[model samples]
Target: MSTATQVPELSVRVRDRLARRHPGALIGELTVLPGGHSGLTYSVTAGDHRYVVKAVPPGQRPVGRNDVLRQARVLGALAGAVEQVPVPGVVAVDETQPAWFAMDFAVGEAVEPVLDEPEVPAATARARMLEIASVLRRLHATDTRTPGLDAPEPLDAAGELERWSRTLHAVPPELRPGGEELLARLAADVPGGMPPVLLHGDFRLGNVLCDGERAVAVVDWEIWSVGDPRIDLGWFLLFADHRNFPQLGHAVPGLPSEAELLDAYLGDRPALPAMDWFRALGRMKMAAIMGHNLRRHREGKHHDPDQERLPPTIAAMIRTARDILG
Candidate 1:
């Protein structure tokens, strides 16, 4: 970090750290990344290596907004983590200045426009999907909760229902269709809840970093929380639940059938919903969340495309919900 070359435009702080890591580590082309709910992310390259720097916005860091802090904790605890899957590494984290840190970046596209061959193989997709299931099993099996991140919450059957209910209630009328009945059934029929496991607050295809058909790293932790293991299961169904749900399964291989995924998740915990019933709840939750966001954006508040998709997205959630509940 040459005081002389520390130019603000190039993420001067990140530039300084790279130089320190390798002495030969030289900062090169800087790229800006968006789609994150909190703070900014940048891809910085030094020499032949690429790294991601995530930090709190200067002065925008709130008391509870400790993403930079939580990342450091998780990455450090899982440091030297070697699973079939890839995970990010924490190189340097600075909590004080710039509210920043850097990590060894995994090499793969973070988001795919659609599930394609290179991205997913139908036969292998199922196996790899199971691999992903194993990863979740391991992450949740551990009792370690990060210090600064939100404290653990109830992961039982009923809690998941109430949680989604709160999210659904936030949505306005015109936006909410058949979501109520779907939610009620899910609430009333609480199955044997899974053991309290580490839940990725947001688990979906879009957040995965893939090296060919396998998930290299699960990115985007701005919403990471410790809660019911079922949340992750429910979340996965949002995208990969039904066999004929979306054309998303065609090009993507090895994807477990909706029944398979649910069985794998429930394991010995409890019986799962009938394939159709599980599919309905999965889609309903997705819609409820989108409806909430759509409501916010309609009022001229939230503007992310992902958020903007809420209104229409929930319609699909409702359609699928009705089909399942009908």
Candidate 2:
């Protein structure tokens, strides 16, 4: 059965668990939060308090440190470590079969839809971009040595290229050649190393929550790890770039250019010479991920109508990677 169809049952499970925790608290609404690719997320209301519960999709095996409990541990560590960029506090965790965890629901709308709104003023859009940049800067500045947070294995660009190369096989046959070409290019010209920092693995406008023009919280910690901070910066920059995915529509007006956002992220530090390489890698990585998701949809392993549009999107990203790498 598709994960979307399982939402009602999952909601019942969450409600029953929360009811036990708070005793007399009433469990109110429980609705799915759309747009996440990895986990099934639901917004649950218990009495007057709202919480977000994320559960592993049924019949899906965990891959690459994406465990719900690991996410909870990261969020718990960040609660005491970083104040500038808000992250939800853990409310409860269930690591058994069909693993799930709940955390306080964060306020504000996702920056994704906000950026697409034409009514949003130019100045307001610019402020939102800057706010996100500031939050990322603060996140990278925080020490990764915080207790309870496990130090991830050192990131190897070559190994990553190999891993994604295998994942590319799952893509539609039409896209496999381009995927292989991108992987070969990345493997051959892997950029030299830089110091690693705590990376919000899927950092982008879509992952941030904005209250008007102010960024209030950075959510979705399932992919959190220690890696080249530029990996995060590159992903955010590509997502903000209009040319990368024209299917997503025109770039938002007044949003900071990539150079400006990079400056904001770097602050007093010298500009990264390998930023372009990282950006190219980010495009390739995202393309491979989309390709994999499309495969799942085609195989009936997952269900989402939106996955229908991913082929052209993945193709566009592959073309972007080629241009950037050239």
* TM-score of every model versus the real structure: 0.77, 0.82
After the best TM-score superposition of candidate 1, give how far the Cα of residue 71 lies from its true spot, in angstroms: 2.1
> In candidate 1, how many Å is residue 26 off?
2.0
Error of 1 at 75 (Å): 2.1
Estimate candidate 1's alpha-carbon lDDT, on a 0 to 1 scale. 0.62
How displaced is residue 17 in candidate 1, in Å? 2.4
Each candidate: RMSD to true structure? 4.8, 3.8
**lDDT, candidates in the order shown:** 0.62, 0.75
| Worst window of 10 by summed lDDT in candidate 1 | 1-10
Off by over 4 Å in 2: 1-24, 56-66, 94-99, 113-121, 169-173, 176-181, 294-312
Q: Estimate candidate 2's RMSD in Å.
A: 3.8
Candidate 1's displacement at residue 56, Å, is 0.7
TM-score of 2: 0.82
The local lDDT score (0 to 100) that residue 232 gets in candidate 1 is: 72
Clash totals, every prediction = 12, 0
